[model samples]
Target: MPSFLQVAVLLAVVITAAKGAGALSKRLGQPAVFGELLAGILLGPTLLDVLHWPVFTDPPYLERLTRDLAELGVIFLMFLAGLETDLEEMRKVGAAAFFGAVGGVALPFLAGTALGLAFGFPLYESIFIGTILTATSVSITAQTLLELGRLRSREGTTILGSAVIDDVMGIVILSVVVALHQAGLAGAGDAAGGAAAVAAGSSGSTAAAQGADAGGAGALAVGLIVLRMVAFFAAAIAAGRWLLPPILRRAARWPGTEPQFAMALVAGLLLAVAAEELGGVAAITGSYMAGVMLTLVPDVKRAVEERLAVLAYGFFVPIFFVNIGLETDLLDAVAASGPAFLVLILLAAALGKIVGSGSGVRPFGFTWMEALRVGIGMVSRGEVALIVAGIGLQEGVISQAVFSVMVVMTLFTTLITPILLRWSFGRAPGSPSGAAAFSPAPGPRSGEAD
Candidate 1:
């Protein structure tokens, strides 16, 4: 545990940094996340250590403390993400969003996995690498639509709906990959023991036979992991619908309205933790579901969003990005990936999202040009992609080289989104819904940027 003074100083740093960076980003016409990421990089090993900050070198606890606070940022982020989801709207554009999200996740993941596998990555690593490519930060695209005042239009609805699916599907893919990776690691451990038994055996035949058994066991382990994940998700879905509502309703009637937010936060985190404990995918799944449920209720949703935004912008988010910067070994990540690999990753990242999302919505009767614009609109990746990549790197499923490649991919995609939205929509003829224009992408009607 950190000392009281240490915690206080760390909190102070996060608030100052986030606010400063956010203001700068807004001024530069960039998304606040860009500034946050930049702030993190500046405070991290790359810059602070390079400049020889005494605090970084002398106190190990400071770094860890920063990380802990930043993690809270991630949680708050997910809470907000959940709050943004609208199930009724999602239902309206279900087909387009479903296909768009599926295609978007599928292609990039496959491309990434294939690249990793071709480079001699193990199966689990390849799968994880691919999983990193799954999420679309629809927030970026939504922002563009908002600037253009097209957010409430059909295309806007389709994009938002698809983005939600994108998040859910991305989490599912990540979970499946994690399950497989865990199984593989366990199997490898078991195989090591089997190999030792063979080495001590009397004959070569016995060694070969043992190796075969180990392989079979590895396959079985993988199967069991998949089964476990399926069971966990099924239980969660049932519980969310059948059990959570009444509990939330009861909590809503309690003494303080603040408890409603508390209940939702507690429920979201618990659900996430439960999912992870059960070998299911992203912990944020529970958070997202909680958001969906809270929105369904008439009175509680506002309080929940209010509390989440306050906590998010106030402290947690800045700390998270700053810690991300501190932990980043940028040179190592870049050196491992190399220029050629980086280029390939970038191309695949852009093409995968554009092609997948663009094609998916066409059957919904959107004009081909509108579909292309939507695809371009959705192409930029953001926080979700970074989170996914961070998970893969932390799990040791991807080397620093692959992780670096992902960072570059994220940077390029995010940086280009505003420009693309501006250029594409600016040329279109004016429409009442503002779907026809591109320069001023839509902003959220909720007026809650936090």
Candidate 2:
């Protein structure tokens, strides 16, 4: 086992490096996350290999500790994501955001899966690749719009709303695909060597029997996956609605300062545990649900968010982003994938979101330019994609090299979005093609930036 001192020192190095890098990135007018990712690469095997210096006798134990911290970062990061979800804003954006998210999700998923198949990946792995491509992070776009004094514009609002819905959709799809992949694995195990069975089934009747058995197994797996997912969502949502409110309301009244914070954290942890053990979904999904539940309470939302941000960002979130780089060997990943897949994946990742999201908003009364703007706005992929990629790696759904390529792809999308979004909005508002108008849905908070 690695000594606690080694772990502490490693964390110190990581946190300092991440914070400094994040500050520099912010100075360059990019988000702090950009710097944090870059720092991870620099500190990882690609450069420093901080996790494997001569001082630490055992590396895996240290790795385990860091990974555990990183996992906490994911939970809090996702929980905050839930907190940011403005339901009222989504309601106002209505069909525009909904269609935008649907299109954003569908096209990317199809395109990514098709690309993976063309590249000779298995069906389940291909689906996982598609899932990786379906995430949208509008944080860069939102910040850009804020800088351009258009954060409250209809396109901006819709992009934010669509992003929120996009996250939820992405999570749901991830769960289903993961369950499907696991089910496939279980069926394969039960087969006890399919090739041997196939060779033995020489007669037509024997072969037919084998086929029927296989078909039956496949059908059962699908049915079970669907039922589990449905039950989880139903129970989780019901708990969020009925169970959470009463618990939180009581916590709000408990003795001691910010008792609700502890209670809320407990709730998130329990839900996260339940999500994996019972719901068969990621723990972060449950945390996210907990966050949404907290949002409903209204009374404790501020307290929880305020306290959580410090704990999350100051430590865990940075580690999570950095650990991504730490675990990735850029040169090996690139070599494994080759230049062609890298370039193609980048293309698929960007175009899938742009075309899918852009076209999705057009029929909903959005002008072509506005639709184009929305598409461009949704182009960035951030933590959501990274989290999914991490899970894919953990579940053995994707390779380390592919994971590294995806990390590179995500950073590329994030960096390029601000420039693209700014250029998209550069056209004069009075121009013929620039007829995008702020038609907020009927509400008191309409036209507000999410």
Candidate 3:
């Protein structure tokens, strides 16, 4: 088959699988994202590969195409992620979210670093482990809340607010790590490679000669990255707020709003491209900021959201989730880390966010129980963790083994979140148990307005 035709056919199958699985998950009282993830695992090397699903057995370039489609999914997902955030509500929970983000990052890094020292894996791998733990998959968490009709509630708002902050902080950390990894500093490469560098840097003239260059390069790279990121964001936000509204206002008056779609399309694509070219920032991130800034114009915001939703959820989101499954290599993680380490990493991954983000709510006047609930609510790692893990694998910062553990971690946390939340709110006020009577009724998809 022609390449484009092959991709189209493969995506159709994957979406059918994801949608069926998603429906099944919702029927079972779980989030659709959970089903989508499960679909990935099943279609992956673990089981259904024997059935010869195209994505599982595709050639490299085809796989690359699938991944590119998936990247678009990520962008749309991030855009919706930006849309769902409420800055005003976040301000109320700001103190707690800030602390939570800090603690979430710190504890995982420290614990992972210490574990690496003890396990003999070297520092870089340890950092990767910690980085994996640092993410709070906002999509999964929001899905859970929306399912329970809690997305509009106090606790839901708090958790959502905290998650946005957590995500922003996570991206910043990723930027730094990616920059360091690229510059051949921060232990050079993976566990084996980094160990060699550490040894040479400690004892060899070669290491000494390269140290200054690595340090200088890393510094310059980080500086350029920060400046570019800031500039892109500043420009997008300012233009979005100051310039976009007037332009959109005029666009609305045009004879055909199909033109509005074109404008929106151009705006999203251009903003995304600009962000990448100018600052090396994820285009989705920049696009999301653009969305957020323009949210004040309700009519324009609603129109863009309506058009984007059909494109995003219908096509891109499913593509992204399915790609996650295809990329997962569960056996490798088990082989590398061994069972015991796997168990430890999973536990740390689950608890790290809970303790960090949960405890940080104390200064924000939330009850201990409320804080705990928020922490548990945020436990679902979902797609973003997998995205980071994929990046780590491609960069060779983590072996297939670590990536496998992350897949397991991501799936486990996502699967269990709804059950956990339901248990905690067992017949309590504002739980999904009370969902039927929720003021704004729950929608078919997560985070969609009634």
Could you give me the TM-score of model 3 versus the true structure?
0.85
Error of 2 at 30 (Å): 0.7
lDDT value, residue 399 of candidate 3: 75
Candidate 3 residue-wise lDDT, 1-450, digit = tens: 576776677777788888889888878877678788788777777666522554334467767787898877776666666655567767886677778667766776676666655777756777877887787766655665655666666667777777778777776676567655655544343334434786766556655556666656557766777787777777888888788788877877789647776676667767777876676665656666666765667787778777777888788888788777877667766877888888887788778777877787767787887777787877877776876777677678887777888888888888777777767655545445435645553222222211
Cα-based lDDT at residue 102, candidate 1: 81
Pairs in clash, predicted candidate 2:
none
As a whole number from 0 to 100, the lDDT of residue 256 in candidate 2 is: 98
TM-score of 2: 0.91
TM-scores of all candidate predictions against the true structure: 0.88, 0.91, 0.85
Per-residue lDDT of candidate 1, residues 1-450 (tens digit):
346665676567666776688678767877777777677777666666422344334366665666666655666677677777778878998788888888888888898888778877777777777777776887767766766777776877888888888888887777777767777788788778777886777377877787788889889877877787777777766776677777777887889656666787788788778767764566665566666666666466776676777767666766776566666667776777666667777787888877878898888898887777677767777778777777787678877667666766776887787787677667445555444455444322111253
Least accurate 10 contiguous residues by lDDT in model 1? 441-450
Better of 1 and 2 by lDDT: 2
Q: All candidates' lDDT scores?
A: 0.71, 0.83, 0.70
lDDT (Cα, tens digit) per residue for candidate 2, span 256-306: 987888888888888889888888888888998888877776667777877
